[model samples]
Target: MNENMNTSTIRGPLDHEIRDQIISAATEHFSHYGYEKTTVSDLAKAIGFSKAYIYKFFESKQAIGAVICTNRLAMIMEIVDAAIAGAPTASEKLRCLFRSISEAGSDLFFHDRKLYDIAAVASRDQWPSAVAHQVRIRAIIQQILLDGRASGEFERKTPLDEATKAIFLIILPYVNPAQLQYNLDTAPEAAVHLPALILRSLAP
Candidate 1:
């Protein structure tokens, strides 16, 4: 075997287990070293695999970062959605969603700065997965508003499209990952107060 040959070509794309391992290793490197300083070769060495093997799974280090941020956002959304699923009223659902999202943000920002930093970069770079995650989050907020309108929890005549966008802007400070560090240190009270304002704005 030629030492110069691309090992990725010799070996097929990695299976699920190997792909997960690469993500796990990449997360560790990214967390400790930060994104710009972390390299594909670094992940390869840390995972006990050749650089080619890592490439066979991830297109680049940026892609790995994107996957990590996107997955984290998706999991948080799942938790938020699940928490609000059984709420008996639209008002309660909106409250649950806001509280759940606030809790998730605290976990990401206050407890895990490293992971939060990675997500901030992903959002700034406009990674496709990150963009998709934002769309899903917006839709979740929209659905809740629509439900509220139907149940007379919110003004029935309000336009949901505009309402959804407005709500996103109103809560942007608390929900945006890029703002997490600032909010955690200086504006902890906003987490509780902003959501209350949103709930009030939705009242019929």
Candidate 2:
């Protein structure tokens, strides 16, 4: 789990098609067996590849998990982006952002618990994919806020960076895999009320 290790250097140039094949098999393996319990050898066996062959594409099991985690998170972001794009106003977009994340997180927790476990590890370990995801979410929120201000739908006095950070903090529980299950019972209600409160706060 040395985050600083240059895994790419260890593997040298990869064959994209073979690398993708490994990733696809590893993702299915992790989804069924869960990330923590599965090893590279197990994945190789399931995929009919030698363990050494798998290592040529990925330096460690975590590297494969990182790719899977990134793809899973990207799916959620795609849903959120579509929701935001379909909304008619900034207020609605903000609400869509919150609701989309809440529903998506809940779906993963309930329907894909094994994958959720991988996300929990990624969040706890501060994986590069998880960190990058957070940055992207913050940027999305900042854009929504800027749009709101430009439309005169929101107050302009607050610093944009602070506002973006605060808004992200408010929604973090819904999105953070480590914290999500604890808040699941309240998520449906909070998803409705929280965005309403935020919109009111932003109103000019």
Candidate 3:
């Protein structure tokens, strides 16, 4: 046994189970304590491991934070992907997009708020990946509209460029975290009205 091994990490096939356990424990710690208040020791105890045992799976607390953030983002992406996959029309895609943003106060996002805050503080002006994520989402929405155009399901009320921006507007605030914190109750309304607003703006 490597005594020098980090407590937050695990190895082998067992490591994955250990890894997920840490993430699960971290999620609860994060939600109640937020980023600053939560500690790796809290995580270890949550998993019934020693402080050093927790380090075995994670090199540092920051590494654990990274895992937490990525997991949450992946969850959000899954929801977004499913929405796009299930949509029969550009209009339906718009509704999913709206719902994505409106419901962003998810456990995943809430738990990883610390990581996001840290990133912004570390380099407020520099997030290439964040920019890229937005670009990809825009591309997906644009593709949906182009498909709508081909199917004659949409009237092409605006050029794709303008329409894409309009679509982004609907979901941007709700998922933004900062924006959604103001009022939690408006989410369902956001899910419904945003699509209607976009359709009104884009449909024949």
Candidate 4:
């Protein structure tokens, strides 16, 4: 049987299951065929639905791809959340999140190049959801900084928002998959020490 072929009903109400199948099919197709090459018709055929029906669920092929990228970002945030959970201090949580995000990006670069490629494209295209996810991530950093301030772990000579932006600017290479790879390739030693350097600079 074809992997994407759904035995369950795809007709009528278009429940969560069908919607998921559509996204899943779209993800597989995007990964294998690239976003520009994958069409709504292609996804509909994979999901055993009409092209019109596919649009009923997603606004466009790009929307589907953007959603997939957003989902991946959510997964990365989960890793960051896990790393922050047991950490003893805000500084430690920030450090843990940074290292975990780098590790996750490295793992994706090494093991799931296609997913990484999709994310890179999403970032390049500046899809709405992808852009929103980036904003959300920056907020997460801001909150971490706020926690650090509360604990007196980090000196905030600047405003929290300003500090957050500055930190994110410095650590962009570690958080961005494309830049992460470039840094790791061109300056392996700097790439390894970048997180710690940022933490120290932020310290009181």
Q: TM-score winner among the candidates?
A: 2
lDDT of residue 30 for candidate 1: 73
- Over 4 Å off, model 3: 1-17, 44-59, 104-136, 155-159
Task: Give the C-alpha miss distance for residue 179 in model 4, angstroms.
Answer: 3.4
TM-score of each model, paired residue for residue:
0.84, 0.94, 0.64, 0.80
Q: Residue 135 deviation, candidate 2, in Å?
A: 0.6
Q: Provide the lowest-lDDT 10-residue window in model 1.
A: 1-10
Give, for candidate 4, the lowest lDDT window spanning 10 residues: 1-10
lDDT of 2 by residue, 1-204 (tens): 546324462363555788888888888888899999998889999999999998887888888888888889999999999999999989999999989999998998898889888888888888888888888889999999999999999999999999999999999998888888899999999889999999999989
lDDT of 3 by residue, 86-156 (tens): 87777787777777645654443355555545333212232333344467677877887888788877876
lDDT of 1: 0.72
Local distance difference test, each candidate = 0.72, 0.88, 0.62, 0.71
- Report the C-alpha lDDT of model 4 over 41-141, residue by residue, as the tens digit: 87788778999877666666665666677788788878878888879888777777667777777777677667777677766666555567668768878
Which lDDT value does model 1 have at 156? 60
Error of 4 at 190 (Å): 5.2
Clashing residue pairs found in predicted model 2: none
Cα error, residue 73 of model 1, in Å, equals 1.4
Alpha-carbon deviation at 116 in model 2, angstroms:
1.6
Best by lDDT: 2
Residue 88 CA displacement from its true place in model 1, Å = 2.0
Root-mean-square deviation (CA) per prediction: 5.8, 1.7, 6.6, 6.3
**Ten-residue segment with the worst summed lDDT in candidate 3?**
118-127
